[model samples]
Target: AKWREPKLDGRITEDLTINELEQYWNPLLFIDNILSETKETQWLMAQRNETGEVYLLERRRIKGVFLETLELNDFPLDVQDLTITVTSERPESEVDIIPDQNEMSAINVQTFVDQQEWKLHEHVEITKRIMKQEYSSSMKSHACLSVTCRAARRPGYFYWNVFLIMFMISSLSFATFAVSPDKAELRLRLSFTLILTSVTFKYVITQSLPKISYLTYMDKYVLMSLAILCIISVWHAIVTLLDPEHIATKYSKPANLFDLYGLQQHKSFLPPDTAVKSTNNTQNETDNFFKEHASLDNGFADNLLAFFLGSEQMEEADQSAESKTSTDNGNLSTSVGDQQNTTVPRLSNECSLDNKMACEEWKRVQIVEQHVFTSFVIIYVIAHAVFIFWLYFDASRRRREMRQKDKDYRDFLRRHQQWQQQSLRQRDMHAILRSSLHT
Candidate 1:
């Protein structure tokens, strides 16, 4: 039941009482501002007295959806202000939509039905506003009661429903970085799966919200998360290109001497063992010839001098003598074979050195890969920390606003209830007096 305090005129007596002969009274009501109306509402009571002072009561069940401009910049942590405006259908000259101060106070936290998605921030606020007439060019001002209900979204619910899934998808994508870049097909497949999972989650989140032109905080967060997944894919692609040779022997022994020696051109440093053996034999033959020819020199002193400081012809004569002696003695061949056997160990040592160098190079490559992974891990951690911290503070700010509004709403409810009880008692007393007079 609603009550309206009517204005009384000075010409009429304030103490005038209604006779028992008149049992009922009806007063005209002019309420044209309500935009969303329900059919369950009906006029039940209208009582009046001689001074034209009227007391009215009506039973109404109002239920309808109101259109509100939602600001989604903050998204999940955003606070929203919803309003229901009641304006007068008539011009200000004819009627004014006066707000009942006492009635407004009666509204409390309990007035708003408990909802899962949003929490009431404060008590409902009522304000009187003057709106211009819509059609007429001569702007006529009409009074309206703007009722504001401030509320905030419960972010925890959204975090679990949407963000939890997104986080999981991003994590799966990051794991792909650990996979060897050599497996390009496998890596690409996993990355695509993770990316698609993120995209699916994005679609789900968007479906829950109204279509809007601007990006919300949730939208930005989701897109950024997907970007992180894409970055992992990109990182792997780069790693693959950087170490293409590594893939061929990814599963082989960590120390690949053959690959290392091949890349460094170890063959260029030494000729074939067969060529080395033939050259060594030729040099030994020339040395023997020089000794034989020296014995036939002008004298021992002359031979020594010629051997130490001789003309180019002295070596040529030595080589010619050696070739002639080799044709005469078959035992010279046995000496050449002995020298070849002695050089075999040196060839084996060179190969061992090459193997050692190759192993060291392989170790260096592994260290480089470790460093790359470590750097990426650090970047990933820092990125997540910043992202999470920002969201935490934003959600906290929304919660603080909601708490303040809720406090105000509770206060309003208490004041309103007290006024309503007092009004009811006064009305009961007035009714008793009228019944006594009639008897």
Candidate 2:
């Protein structure tokens, strides 16, 4: 409840006791939106201004929890309004509520202890409104005043801990490509691991925020990263299923280029006496051909080809091939030797064809992977940029609306003051006319 007293003489401002304040009329005012009250204290003070106008002030200090609605679409970058509403029990005809023109509402930010998480603004907003209550078809209007303060959530914590971590984990999914595409199990395992990590991190982040149905900015980012991870895993599966080398390794053992070339070029390293011994061991050689090529799997085949084809190793391999060819000509005596020579060339040609096809397929998949990664990066950047621009423009629009409201309120106060002065002058003139008529 609020009460005030007026006196004719100027006096020093002093606090009045509650018993003394009961002698004056009081407006029954209460906070309408408070959830719970911890403590409240109130006092009255009287003072006179320079113009000899006496005024009474009711000072109140209240500490309690209040109810408020928060919109979290922007989430980590969102601003919230904290409001306190005071409503009078008496109708508008018996009580009036208005902002004090001589005093401006303000907030003391120096005392705020949660500065690390939220930034509190010093400017306070006061609004006067009339609310109508209906009781059995009868209506009464009550005066209400609301004071609001704005606070913006600090995004730095979420940026580093949540968003940055999510981005890094999502990017690691791309590194799965470093593993051979034929090793689909390894690549898929890595991709799924990153995806699960992102999902768990999202849950941890969500625990810090209120449960809401709509997606926030941070939620959108996490979902985007998750989608990218899913795409990466799917691509890995697709490439593995479509790859010729992977299929060959899965169904039947294929002769790899490494075993075929290595055996042909190093055959000359055997001693002259072992040459006939080696030729006689044709059956053992046939068994070793399947064993050696079967172990020469497709993992890192392209990388090995790239290293050997572009380095001094290729020159050494060519020299070894020439020496083996000369040694073969010198030992072309037995019919079994001629048949072995023909079989080596035929096996070499088949291995070369299979290797070339697999390499081309891998190269095509690599190009597609590069394009996909670049597209995802571009899309992510553009989406975030658009979101930021929308937030910026939305904030600017809200500020403009607030300024317009303040301007309109000022105009209303000015007009109300002029109307009061006009009424006073007319009343005085009517009294003077009545006095003259009585005379």
Candidate 3:
């Protein structure tokens, strides 16, 4: 509100109470989007310049919560705008709310309570627009002014507690490969455990966010980790089903010829009483042969067999062989030679076949597991890199937009100042012409 007070020059009145100010003009201002008004204080002041023109300025300080819609596609990495919109009860034709060109809106960042979770920007944006009345059938619009402040969520907390934990859990699936391929039960158990852990972690993370229909970036990452764990579990089952030793046992028939030769060879090297005892245990030994060899750990079985057959027996057998008559020794030698000639070649051929099959199986399992691990690593790296780049570009775009807005605002202020100066000059010219005519 403006008025002319010829009696006053470069003077200002004290702050007027609400009642006193209501005696004059009022715009009937109120917050449009406020949820609740906590406290409000308003006062008016009158100031007169050297030209005897008085200006009435109304100042209001309000504290309250305002409603804002959030976009959570980026979630923990997103920036949000908090706005306070003010609108007048009077229509736009009667009351127009405009920003003060001389005073730019601002926010005090030091007063923000969520400093650890959000970085509040100091600059405030003021937008003035006409809002159409929804209830009115006529084309009625209200003057609305919105003051907005931006705040960026700090992602470090989520990165450490959620993303890092999920990555570690998914990585545990790769460690399951260290278990032998034949132990599919153990590998699968570990993989499933990782999957469950990931799911539970995701649930905990979701509880901290709003219930939205679409997935957030963090949700996508967790899902990818779970998928990788499931793939690992399936691979474990595949490798176990294709186990070489199990296949060989299933297809190969028992060769009693090798067992008979093995028993005779042990008896031939033992002393008389020891040979009798060995003969007695021969049936039991032959029964356990298939079971032991089926689960053999490559060459470790040979060392285990020698360790079980005591060294004392070997020394006694050596003494008995030295004492034996030449005729008996020659007959024993011929018998052993006959057994070797008949059975050794066949046994060697069968053993070689089993070894070749085992070697091929090992190579196939290694190739597949290596490929899976490498592929998962590559995909994980690429996914994180893409997310990082997206965040960087998004922040850059917002910064550019803010800079452009500031530039435009400055230009508007310059033009407004020029127009005001021109109007004042025209008024002075009119006043001079009037004085000249009166003279």
RMSD of each: 14.2, 11.3, 10.6
lDDT for residue 311 in candidate 3, whole number 0-100? 33
The candidate maximizing TM-score is: 3
Q: In model 3, which range of ten residues has the least summed lDDT? A: 267-276
Give the poorly placed runs of model 2, Cα more than 4 Å off.
Answer: 1-18, 50-53, 133-139, 246-287, 290-363, 380-439
lDDT of 2 by residue, 1-439 (tens): 3233564245444555556655666687788889999999987656566556656666789999999999787777777888999988888998898887655565677999899998776556888898876652557889999999877777788889887888789778878878865577899999888988888888888888889899987898789889888988998888766554453333221223434446554232221122223433533564454444433432323223322232333454345344444444223223223434544444333333333444455556667767876876777678667756866676445444545655665676677678878977998899899899999
| Candidate 1: Cα lDDT at 87 | 62
| Model 3 lDDT tens row, 8-70 | 335455544546545766678888898888999876767655466766667888888889999
Candidate 2 structure lDDT: 0.64
lDDT of 1 by residue, 304-339 (tens): 222222233246434544554634334443433343
Q: After superposing candidate 3, which stretches have Cα over 4 Å from the reference?
A: 1-18, 135-139, 250-351, 394-439
Give stretches of model 1 more than 4 Å off.
Answer: 1-40, 44-60, 93-98, 105-114, 120-122, 136-138, 244-365, 412-439
**Native-structure RMSD, model 2:** 11.3
Clash pairs (backbone) in predicted model 2: none
